[model samples]
Target: MAFESFSEFLAMGTHGPYVWSVYGITGVFLVGMVLQTLSAKKKQLKRLHSILVKDVSEREK
Candidate 1:
């Protein structure tokens, strides 16, 4: 399945659209997952910080 030229490689023998679209969609999905994971971790850390502060304040009183 060797392409004789760059044009043929890009065309992917008429299956270019499907192959390129799949790659694009997969890239977007991976980026979205990474962002979601980062957001969740930030939220969890904020909540933990608040809880720790409250515990310390309670002990002082």
Candidate 2:
């Protein structure tokens, strides 16, 4: 509503590139962090499961 037209909104009065780039960088960083967390969690669970299985086998012997 503040912008007179769609072009003006995209332009953002000469600040469009900076604003959009910040948004893009933030989005990429957030996605990367989420992916990293998921991967780490999966690895941790797998390691724990293996440890538990080994312990159970040792106890059985």
What is the Å distance of residue 29 in model 2 from its true position?
0.9
RMSD of 2: 2.4
lDDT of candidate 1 over 4-41, digit per residue (tens): 99999888999999998999999999999999999999
Candidate 1, pairs of clashing residues: none
Tens digits of per-residue lDDT, candidate 2, 1-61, equal: 7899999988999999998899999999999999999999999999999999999999999
Lowest-sum lDDT 10-residue window in model 2: 1-10
For candidate 2, give the lDDT.
0.97
Estimate TM-scores for all models: 0.64, 0.65
User: Model 1 residue 7 lDDT?
Assistant: 90
